[model samples]
Target: MRLWLGLPVASALPRAHLCVFIPISERSRKDGALSLAALGTWAQEQLQRDAGAKVRFVSVGSTAGSPLEPYTLHVPGDEEVGYKRLPVRILKIWHYLGQEDDCDWVMKADSDTYVNLRGVSDRLSCFDPEEEHFFGVVHAIVPPRQLREMWPALYFGHGGSGYVVSRGLLPKVGRSALPCLEDMLEMTQGDAMEDVIFALCLQRRLDVQVESYGFLRPGGAWDAQLAEQEFVVNFHQARDELLDRRPKAPLQRWLHWDAQPPPLHACVMVAHPVENETDMMEVHRKLRADAAAQVLALAPTASEWAEPERMPLGLGRAQCVPSPMALARQAEVRLSAAGAPVKAFWTPKQLEQLSQCLVHSLGKKRCGWTDIREQRYGLSYWPPAQSSDACAEACCRSGADCSLFQYRADEGCWLGRWEESQAVASDKVWQGAVKVW
Candidate 1:
């Protein structure tokens, strides 16, 4: 991971690369002196101690610092509004690539962000860096009232959260898109936000595909339980205080394949003979109601058997046999040969484990509603319900597809699809009930 820091600065640089990047006016240099000293010290420590991949910290600004002259790259721009800074910095990186093009990805971030570099490298390995790709926790931005007419749809990654651009796409952006971008910046009188400008250039102008990932951001509310998982990558708006507070874990801790438990892939071999399609449907419904059973295909007749030649059990067409016992025996043999753990009889404990595994593998925990209410979107209406409990029961009985229900005191229940139910601010009379896994 050849990581380079394209930090924009106005006044003094921090000792650590992680220090906050707050551009200061020329008059405030005295106030920034101490922070600059701290930054120099931190830079020395990083140079001495960090034995992994070498990270090049290049500070970008209008003028080079007296002390940090070696690390600073002087780009022509006003220090106050560095609108052209990013594209220029990126172009400079591309120029550096002309000399040494070994870097797989380029990360553009503010100094206040705490980046798990190993986590980023691991995530990038999943995609082809040779292709035009962009990654970030994407945010849909509504333009300011004054700029709304000129810029209608402004979708960008929150810069505080940070974003990554592939090396292959950077050169193209610099060559083809930068001129248009600079014009936009001039038009906005430097008011266009840097992240938004980058987003517009990549998506609207150059047509680069931006993929969103769930990397944590500062002040963004996330499931506290899930945030503890290894998948979370960065923390935005981090302060210097974190250096002493957080533990020094191995960088490899952040690098792991995001492997979820495999889905419960098993076939329910019906041992009892079925008369018709209705009988088969009823049997399928009953088995599916158990939750543990993900019955992919069914053998409803004695003439139908799960073929061992199919090996993995459910993928191929079902085979016919003389008896129901033959079908069960065939299913057991085939599933066992395919390396799946086979049991002669499924105990309640085993079934429960299977159900739990299915839930974990799917990764979406069902949402529950108690006193909450939503407006205007209902899939279907049911008969008059006396209470919320009755409405909930109705939703449950409506099969697994039913996601929610809204019930009025004297009226019936409204069955709703999960996507349609958007919560409204006003609380009228209706009570809502949502299915929880």
Candidate 2:
């Protein structure tokens, strides 16, 4: 059976290939030991048990303490004032770890962040350790003139989000970039972010290849909606309470690629006939061409798409209907027959009702469960309610495959294909709609 959409089944990497390092302080050792360190150990054990993937996790701290005695690697630095010396400490750890152990990739993470090692292994499988590759959630620095004197341009991964460096780039960075950074730190009196400094070393000095990945959760208030994401690799700034309650939230099922089977293409029936024959002809031509190209690129036959099991959650074959109302009705039929998730185009009137229901539910501090058939439904977005109702309607009308609508104050409206299983309590500003058929 297929695991996650688009991603193929990946083979496990050898235990010696991957290493994860977490930077902790002496003061926060207890909390770190109970939270991040415990989670990392659990993740490693789980992956080893489930997928036969071996991963090493280590804690890097400056001070010697009982809490860190088991797996801690004591580097030469002052633990109390380590923030200013973070870049130096990181370099020292890299060099020291390189000498002590043989690893293909070295990942640096914060004490509060939770990592999904299986996802990390899967992502690393795509690149070679010999290549000078840097992987992380990339962020560009925009200026209002604070440190223009030290560096001209700056781009770096948010360190709380974590980053990975290949074995090939380590020596180059140590040889060339570390000395320059040391001189710069001495001249500037050490007030730079470690992530920015590292990125400058990789991108500006060595000109290594940087690959951005979206596995890191954005920094914001906690949203339970994120638990539904199929490919989330890490969560930063997670609350201690949440982690205590749901420790397994960071690791989802691993996605594996399955062999191609017979294609089952859905027939599109244009319920609403267009006025101009030429316009209809052009539409048909474009659709046919696009479908043919997709089949040629990924499938063995024109009639076959990836099996429904392999498709992304809340996605299925497309169907054309006469109007938003007709589409909703058709969706009801599909939802009732197969009891599968279905998407429907919504009219402005229907969208307005959804928005009002969401607002009302939010105000009442209750889940926004709209009545669809005999059951209640809610919106399904990661950040939840990304846009306005008007924007959502426009998206539904513009695209041939939009099914759900959500609107939030200041954020505007968003269109999505999948429906959320349940409405978790969210910000009061968010609103959503589900098909009521």
Candidate 3:
């Protein structure tokens, strides 16, 4: 009984869920109607056949009350061309939905066009042809060879490569939560259009398939009439006219799924391996907020942490890990008996990574890294455990401090500074680790 109430057929789609996300510029729609002339009906036809298909038509626009500061961000240059930002935003929304809802297939495309539905359906249904799931495109943009003669730069474009994506292939949100590829591009190189660069993001960040659709019309784009007869999903202003002539939702005439579904109770979807990406950013977000509070408490006497450094900082020389249960004797310390103690060296790169992780987890603060020598120590952020509170409280009572963050593997907690009667290294194997007296 996981009851979710939404549009009809929400539950039925997951077995073969295909999500159609069409994000159009609200003002960009032609002729004063949310529906494009002749396009809406045909787009609907592409989806009508599948009872599980969910077609989400979204219009993006800035509200009147929005302030000027947001103008640059809200109306990025890409909006003028109806290029890729809105699609990115729409995918993000769909991703958020997938976390809570039950759609497994995601189809993102333009508003004014028609897709070849039957051709797409045939390609889609053939999940095991060359590969089970992949990216299909309608067109490709490529520069030409002899184009150097006249226009010199207007050659690289291909047609009939459709855009298709399956739901099971979504990218994991990073635990470290990397920047939007566009932002990264701006910092690395001068900014470039996201449409051209989006492919790179998919390959580098998400590592999913990004091949062109075998049945797409490419750059020239398909018109309403020929598109209807040739493909299952035809693009642009042609759907309504096509549907109007025939007058029926495709669901009435489509194929019924023959595969019997497994029982719903505890049915499992083996999470697609991120391979390396971590999306447990929520864990780090909380860790950061907590660390910020703790840090503020650390040097409250100072107005802010960013005061220019009068001197370079160090974590101090080596420390030692004392014998275990030593605290019981007289504020004893416990060292693991197994192997050499771990060395907690503070490299600048590691420090910066830690700081970024903290900032990412915690939001920007008035303070920055300090120049003080590392009299104090820090630990990696691990996810919280049930015993975390007890261990943290015990350490605190015993005069210790700690922090927790979600690692790529799982939630981990790191214990920090501990008082010792005899100085010891926190980790012994690393050189120069000794406990402070």
Candidate 4:
């Protein structure tokens, strides 16, 4: 069976760790309304207004663009734009930013996309920056014909919408993904899809957890109504469709303001395919205006406005499971704290008692528990727990169905029930126990 996991539960770092990366093409830069110059200028202005915000917008592309903007980075690659060279371009991008250590997360957004820092921050608040995670719109579709043999059922994150990589995994992309480059090119016969190859490298090589959020969508319009119902963070293909100039329909009447020219709402975090400078500005202006209006609405009086309380990270999602990496960090902290505070409490009598307890520790703890589960199973297949004790406690309180508990250093904890089995020698790696009373 295919094992699927939910989103992250622990929030170790703040949203300041997220870095926004956008890829722009020369064709889009020159002719398309969603040019690098337009998007970069707007993003730079937004960053300027919020001086304290550390969310950097780094745009990457070939060398043949106009003098690069402060937020834009030019990588050395052929200026060709298509699926054939996308993998190389993406590799170049990763290689360029491989040494990024300040931010714990990198969000790769399209150039035409208008990203809302607040929205992105909210969506990512619950995730741990130290852990390896890949988030985007996940599609379980077939790869190109040439790659069918290599990847039978390819599950990839759609890059057109946007995708995020945690700091623990992003750095390894450049250094680790190089070995598979030539093989990947040959497998696809030079027609490589960036998102597919990216997913493969992360899942197969780095063992990063692939997560999908329902709120993160591909093509949709943002308005007050849709924003309220769906917590949409990324709205792809935000450009207008067909403009009817035929007799009766006026510009305002003909345009679907809700979809095409997106109506400004505080809920929208990122809107893509804004194919023109004018639409980009319009969306930007509406966002700013709505933000100011919200501030005014929240004020007790016209002149006096209380600062809004910031929601703590990791509280956005309801039920969550802490990742293995997060559990390891927690274990380290617990170990350090356990020793630091009791340095002075070790008197002569206490030391003697401690030595005695350590000597008889194994027999005492092992008295009321059986290692039946360890003889038949391992904790590698179980979900992660904060500690072994926590895992056993969870099994105890998990009702009659939970008869066995297993724990390991790397895998955390496992709880299950199976037919009664003969007792076997206990193991250090997979410690399985069940309380008698």
Candidate 2's C-alpha runs over 4 A off are 1-15, 29-31, 34-41, 44-68, 76-80, 98-101, 145-153, 215-437
Candidate 3: segments with Cα more than 4 A from true spot: 1-16, 31-40, 45-52, 61-91, 94-101, 128-132, 138-162, 171-178, 181-194, 212-437
Assess the local accuracy of residue 33 in candidate 3 as a C-alpha lDDT between 0 and 100. Answer: 35
Root mean square deviation (Cα) for candidate 1: 23.5
On residues 1-437, what C-alpha lDDT tens digit does candidate 4 reach at each position? 21101112235533345576666665554333454434443455454234212323333443344434444455544345564667766766666566555456677766666666555554455455676767765554554667666655655666755678877776787676565566676777557778777877777777663555323222334333233221222233233322212345332322332333334454455565555676667666555555555655654364332321221111111111222222221222210121112111112332222223322322222324666444544222333345777566555544444567777777666665544434457555566786665
Predicted structure with the largest lDDT when compared to the true one:
4
What TM-score does each of the candidates earn?
0.40, 0.45, 0.35, 0.53
Clashing pairs in 2: 8-256, 8-257, 9-256, 9-257, 263-304, 272-322, 387-412, 387-413, 388-412, 388-413
lDDT of 1 by residue, 179-206 (tens): 6546665776445566776677676667
Error of 1 at 245 (Å): 10
The TM-score between candidate 2 and the true structure equals: 0.45
lDDT of 2 by residue, 1-437 (tens): 22111122233523345566666665554435543343333233544344223333334443345544444545444233457767766655554554432457777766544444544544454356776767775555644455555544455656755788777776676565446557647765556677877776676567763444322223332343232122222212222221233365542323211111111111221101121233223323333443344544555563454442222111111211122322332222211112212312232333343333333322222122242222123422222223444534433442433455556566454444444344445445455555332
- Checking candidate 1 for backbone clashes, the offending pairs are 14-39, 15-38, 15-39, 15-40
Candidate 3 has an lDDT of: 0.30
lDDT score, candidate 3, position 75: 17
Return the lDDT, model 3, position 352: 31
Report the candidate with higher TM-score, 1 versus 4.
Answer: 4
lDDT of 4: 0.49
User: Which 10 consecutive positions of candidate 1 have the poorest summed lDDT?
Assistant: 316-325
Worst 10 residues of 2 by lDDT: 256-265
